[model samples]
Target: EVTVKGRFLNQRVAPCQLEVRGAAAVWGDDGRLTQWLSTQHAQGTVAPIAAANGVAETQVHILTPDVGGGFGAKIGAYPEELLLGVIAKKVGRAVKWRETRSESMVALGHGRAQLQYITLGGTKAGKVTHYQLWAIQDSGGFADMGTILAPFMTRPMSSGVYAIPNIECRTTSVVTNTTPVVAYRGAGRPEATAAIERAMDLFAFEIGMDPAEVRRINLIPKFLEPHTTVVGQTYDVGDYETALDKALQVAGYTELRAEQAKRRARGDAKQLGIGVSVYVEITGGVGNGESAKVEVLDDGRAVVYTGTSPHGQGHDTAWSMLVQEQTGIPMDKIELVWGDTDLVPIGTGTMGSRSLQQGGNAVFAVAGELVNKAKSVAARILEVSEADVVLDKDRGAFHVVGTPAVTKTWADLAIAEKSTGGLNHNDVINVSGATFPFGAHVAVVEVDTETGKVRHIAHTACDDAGKVLNPLLLEGQIHGGVAQGAAQALLEEVMYDADANPITSNLADYGFISAAELPSVTVVHMETPTPVNLLGAKGIGESGTIGSTPALQSAVVDAVSHLGVRNIEMPCTAERVWQAIQAAR
Candidate 1:
């Protein structure tokens, strides 16, 4: 039996296609499209699509409507999309091409098919000193980002929440005649957490130490500034020990352990298992910046153009809040426009948890600039020097210093500017840097030794993604991410037969998780703001996914630890668990 079973299968969903219509054409200088289809980078597509078509970049006009749901799979422009325009031009009619769900499964991008081997060493006293990981990534028919990025992403986070002195991680991506790999919720970072956390547990078990205490002994001391790991990840700020403490406290770790001991003493048929995982992930995507423009329209309403395209990160509401905070415009008066490159000519687009820190920072920066412009305009209009102007956020108006009686509404200043020129303020926030978001998750499960059934009971998590801008949205992201992570550990996987044909190809065959399989999560809040961006924030988008996957997988293994079970692979199906139990016997 493998002493260390670390299959951190933190992956996301498959591609589902819909009927698409229209002629794909280049945009003319008149800022009109010859024809179009659905995409996020409407304006951003012009140059690249035109170049590919041997036409002027100016000929491409892309339009993006609010997507139904992409998760990350729909971001690329495939050969089929390029062919749509060509076929339309050839046939002289609007071209419609839609793939069946089965076709999408085979042709579209797939997420997170990785195999990892981990080894961790520490003192018998439970102080982890070293870690090593080797991974094999299934790139599938083509070399997509998943094959190239996941393993590289794995190295930076190789040590996870522990302060290991020596660490090494190596991965090889091999292509197969299968669906191309792509980015999922947590991408490569989840695998790192999975490996390290499991190794920590194995170390703890071998040394007869409590898992929680082992984690505490090895975590980096709390740092208010950036802390660089031996692996070369510079965390802007973190309180990993506190996150572990909070998660343990919330899960009643001591009580659970006591219960576990009594159950073990009695040789109970149903065993209680507890799992813990602490993780820190890099966000904002390797220094790629985002863009935004805050324009005070002639009508006094605020319009924000941003490059961070969101599938469901609530960019609209979040961007509006950022603009209103700086510009003294009511949330209702602020409008967010994006994905239409004509309206927002430049943007990096959203993926990799970059929308807020990069995209929102751009909006915040430019909105502050717009307010400065408004201050000057208000000063001139109110017969006061620019230095004498101040903004009253409560009133959404600007007034002369110490002269509240003379005020100008944001709308009034915009109308004045439109009479002369445009552009109150516009800027693109560029950062050749990244932010790290950290968290701890605990999972409780009950395993039926007789039938080898695993039932997830309760879950508790403490995710610190820096300063939270919106608690509701952050929690929503956490809930969704946790679900996906848990599913990967216990129920989900993309499988192939001996012939390299897919076995789990559809919903009927694939183990897509539903509410019936999960328990509500208890979230403990914490924040250690990153200095990486102006928002004092990190990425919460993938935090839960990275943390929860290992926690659940470890819990299942923990439940059967008394059975001499050391490791069990992911999607811990009853059959697999039973087989492990039998082999141990």
Candidate 2:
């Protein structure tokens, strides 16, 4: 039946599959334990490992050094991490676990294994009125935090970017004879966006309407402040339509339609298809706060300590920039310290895209406090009242108001302060709520009708994750996330046989996409600025993965829709596409 209602991981992230990092643990003789780990969360890892090993919390010292490609998999203590501590205790020696690239395929956690059932009701004019989603999440042999949290997270995102008047969602986390599923890229949010977005496309197809038009008709109107969806997530400021408009403009959607028309008119062997997706995802969703400490050194340089951990998010460089912006310190002269429990005992660690908005904001806040503290010192040194002291930020010095030439440099104050208790400030930034970073994506793909092979052609995205702190880091996050999303849509999947034997458990056997497979993504930036925090920032960590999957998958199916094909399962491989085409015929 038809209706007129409508509607879509890696470091360096190169084409080749990269190796997962290793972990080593050592229990010392002083009843004090030390661990050398490569992880996204040092404090996040220590507590669990300590509990599992029957050690006191104070006895554990966790150190993280130069981790690579954590994404979401390295946030917590895995079974392998516990194994090291156990072995080290019995053998009286340090134990380490280095997973080979092939071993990681089976030993490491897998993500996004869900059986979803979605139904949507909408008007012929493209206004979505009601929606429903149900899913069976495969928790695999061991149920971890990711499995426990997936269903809860999925419910709040049921409404996605639309203002559907009525909505219902349900999910069951079940144990299966497969590798345990954990957070990867967008985690449960991606699954939510995927289902709703797919439902919208299906509704559009049934109603014979444009997918983009259907989305626009149902989008939640622009909001300058907090707007709560029916599903219970309160989004910060956003203009979803503007993001969509920008993506359409950059993608040249009208021209793409003309090309598709010609291809269909001629019944060409290769066909053009375009897919559109508009999305909103929650970031800093779990722990909405992070801690920071800033100290002004005698040399006029700054040292920053942060609770949030980083694998590839570049907290060092990003936090330095935050300090530089707030204080007169040069970005190069600022030093960042993180992920070591011995040095930083209290931390929330990194997960759920909470780092920059929480951790980075703390850096900015503490630096500003340090500047205020320095003002009194400047007044004393310059033989003036506190009211007379003013910062000359351009010259990185403090002087009396309207007296730029009579200035005392930060180095001078820092040196003087060394004898009078060096200036230091610490703070924790707590946002009122989790921010909803929204955006739109357009994917264009070419299909070879004769072979059912899909070729990625052009892609454009408008990601609005409130106030980008570092444009380069933001782009890198998007680029990396897009690659992982495209992989799941077009190729990668963890498989198991009837006997619970792992299949496609190695990079060679599993289909991982490469640079040769992906097109250069054209991204447009939109900054709506969240009011929840000082930086006016939200999380960009998972936006690309949340938006790219459906866009690419929908494009593949649209390419062959003229031939009666309506849907194709994910990992839309040549075999699956061929089978769908044959059955449709």
Candidate 3:
């Protein structure tokens, strides 16, 4: 039997605060308060302010312009935001507030900061049989979104990609004199994945087996139908093994192992280590669904209004592509609008990797509906039966099925409907359930045994995001996610002394990752379409972070494991690595 135990820390994210932005409000004489803010969710900001000020929801209005960055910090309504309206009414004038960079670091909500205790038991033959986990979450002086993450996010994914027959998990959140915890990029899922991956590596070390092979022997088989785990979490579909195979092949896993062996034989001070991680996460699961509006102007240009706010996710380009694909409108002619309560009053407001899967799905559905509406108008203008009219998608026109020359363009149809509500379609789309996007990542590192300095040499990531609409955008998202993941594993951390005074409170003190520190990542593409939404797409927003954090951490530990080291805590700094090595010797 093999027994492995370790404590994994998902350190707090302090720098993910509102940057160079402010909120302004004016109390109008008509008993309406209009405000403009830098936030990911304008609708989310409206209701709270209205309720706190003792006014109807319609009395409060919010408009969010281009936000620099949110990650997850701007999703909720803050005390200052709720007080802006009251302050404006009291002063009888417009009021505005913006935090300095130093203040933003401590005032804004933090993320992660969970301490996990994990244990795994398995046979000598490399089959994991039982797994147990206990997570202690730091809610940070207030019960916020981070309080429920352990139960709703970590516990549900405790089984991970493996088919362990017996599993037990428990979670507890304790209030501490730290910054309030909120969702970061991968939120609770990353912490869950990190815990399980660490346990798997430790178990492999105990049995003297290759970690990758141990994982392969225990992974869940690919399933098309919804499959539920022992922990009662149901996955829509997953092909974890295929993702693993692709990652290994792309990373030249055999050559890496051979190099490591040679280094060990020569007793080289610098050692090569390879690490692997397979992960599946939930997306498009935040709310019931999303809302979208598609309209054709008289000039034939299309417009899309979505409830999903875009801080930096490139929603304008993505939503336009969906409109062009469905309605035959050119990408350049499409316009996107969002984040204003008057313009887009109903919205779920982009979190949980839900934008592309839910918001884009809604746009795809509404644009298709607009096409049908245009066809009906075209049939009336051509004086033909609706069944006889056929749309020439390449030409963006409609005509009789047999005749191609005489056609009605989208502009013409819009002009004809000008007397009516115009050519427009808007609706809130509801999907059956959430989507699970799975992937694999392999990280290669060179560690100096004497000094315990680690250098990330190579990385290969295979993320299956389910029917990618735009490869450029997908790759960009993957690259960004990888950078953040690497930061959490090897560079970034938020620390405080015993009295709760932050030690690394500002950028100068924080170990933020930079481009110079990261290797050029090789992204391996794989697609498995989902049946839950119309576009058959899943979320790529958080996959890179989910896979890379564990891979990097595992690589650092594996580099010095021959010295009898079982594990080292995250942000595997040189000091920590050296301490572990000396203790092991």
Candidate 4:
């Protein structure tokens, strides 16, 4: 039996630096208030702004322009944003507010300031059967979204990819004088992964077993149907072991371990360490559903309106592709509209990795519905039954089953329906349930024992986000996710003085990860379509961040584990590693 315990410090960091908080509000000639802000959820902004200003939801209109990045920081409406309209009405003119870099650090909600205690018990042969985790969350000055993440996000995914029989998790939130915490990239999911992964590594160390082998033994068997964990969180579908095998193959796990053995035998100053992690996360699990509308214009072009706002995720390209695939319209001719309340009207915004699975699924469903509506128009013009007319899809036109030469194009259908509402379909699409996107990661690092400096030399990530829509877009999400996860593991921390004042408020003092510090990532693709959504796609947005964090952390710790160093807090800087080594000696 083996049990290990430590605090996984999820240091705070600014959500996004490129785009700070800014808002413009105007009290129009009418009683309604028109406000424009950088936010993830436009519909979400309506209720709060309406309540604060003592107006109806219809009276408040929110328009979201191009947002640089949200990372959950911009999801909630801030006091500054809420006051913009009130201030504008009082001043009798349009009001605009932009936060300075220094102001944004304090004003923006922080993320991932949690302390975790984890314990694992099993046989000496590496069959993990029991697990327990206790998370003490820092809610900061307010009981915001951060307050509930521990129980909601962390506790639900406590079992991860392991088939541990008995598991227990406890969460407690405390109000601190520091900045209020909100959701970050991975939010509470990363904290959960970090805790269990670190425990697994310690368990491996005690039994003198390979960490990878230990994980392989404990991973849940492949499942195509729904499977519920001991914590009562049921996953839609997962094939965790295949993902692990693929990641190991791509990363050359055996070769890396061989090199580490050689370095250990020679007592080299620079030691090689290989870390592996298999992760499963819940996505498309938040909110009621998403809204989507597809309309064919008089000029034959198509327009897609989505409830999922795009800050940086390529919703335009991806959504357009879904429309084009259904309507046979060229992608260049397809346009996407979002973020404007006057336009979208209803939205859950883009967070929790719900955009593609929920929002994109909406687009795909509505586009298909539009095609069906168009077929009736084609049948009316052709003087035939609706069943007799079929869409060619190649030409974006409808034709008789046996007569391809004669076709009625989308423009023709739009012109015929001009007397009515034209060729369009709009609705809110709901999924059967949340999907589980699972994956594995391999992180290889070189640690210099003398200086206690570590270099992340290689990383291979295999993420199964269900059926992929766009390979390029999927890769972009995974790459960005890996970078962010790697940043939290190696560098980036929000520091505070004794008086609860932030000292690392600016970029100069903060340890933000740069492209120079990251190695070119190797991404492996895996697909296990979920039955919950029409598009069969889960979420790739947070998978890399979730899987890579623990792998990188484990790699850093494994590098010095032979030196009697069991654990080190995150942002494993040279100083921290050096201190850990000295303490071990």
What TM-scores do the predictions have?
A: 0.94, 0.95, 0.98, 0.98
For model 4 the local lDDT of residue 376 reads 89
Which scores better on lDDT, 3 or 4? Answer: 3
Ranking by TM-score: 4, 3, 2, 1
Candidate 4: worst 10 consecutive residues by lDDT? 1-10
Q: Per-residue lDDT of 1-585 in model 4, one digit per residue for the tens?
A: 766666677777777548998999998788899999899898899999998899999999899989989988899899989988889888899989999888888779998988888878999989998898999999889899889989999999999989999999999999999889999887888888888888899899989999989999999899999999999999988888899899999999898888898999899999987889989998887875799999888989988899999988999999999998888888998999998899899889999999998999999989988988888899999999999999887787889999999999989988889889888999999888888899999999999999989899999999999999999999999999999999888998888899888897787787888898899999998899999888899998989999998898899888888899888888888889889989999
Which model, 1 or 2, shows the larger TM-score? 2
In the order shown, what is each candidate's alpha-carbon RMSD?
2.8, 2.9, 1.2, 1.1
Please provide, for model 3 over 1-585, each residue's C-alpha lDDT reduced to its tens digit, 9 standing for 90 to 100: 888888888888764543655899898889999988888888888888899889999988898989988888888878887888889889989999987776777878888999999889999999999999999999887999989988899899889999999999999999999889988887899999999999999999999999999999999999988999999999988899999999999999999999999999999999987889999999877987889999999999998999999988899999999999898889999999999899899999988889988999999999998888888899889999989988887888899999999999999999999999899999999888899999999999999998988899898999999999999999998998888898888988888998889888788988888888899999999999999888889999999999999999999999988889888898989899999999999
Best by lDDT: 3
Number of the candidate with higher lDDT, 2 or 4: 4
Task: Itemize residue pairs with steric clashes in candidate 3.
Answer: none
What's the best-to-worst order under lDDT?
3, 4, 2, 1
Candidate 2 C-alpha lDDT tens digits along 1-585: 333222211111111225475888787779877888877789877778889889788888899887776767777777787778888888998878887776777767777777778779877777888887777777778777446644677778878999899888887888877777777777788888888888888888888899999999999999997888887777778799999999999999999999999999998999998999999998887676778899888888889999988777889999998888777789889998998898787788887888888888888888898888889899888889989888877778899999888988778888888876787788776778788898999999999888899999988988998988889999988888788788888887676788878777666788888899999999898999999889989998889988999899889989999899877888888988889888998
C-alpha lDDT score of every prediction, in listed order: 0.78, 0.82, 0.90, 0.89
Angstrom error of the Cα, residue 355, model 2: value is 1.2
Clash statistics: count for each candidate: 5, 3, 0, 0
| Residue runs of model 4 more than 4 Å from their true location after superposition | none
Name the lDDT value of residue 577 in candidate 4: 88
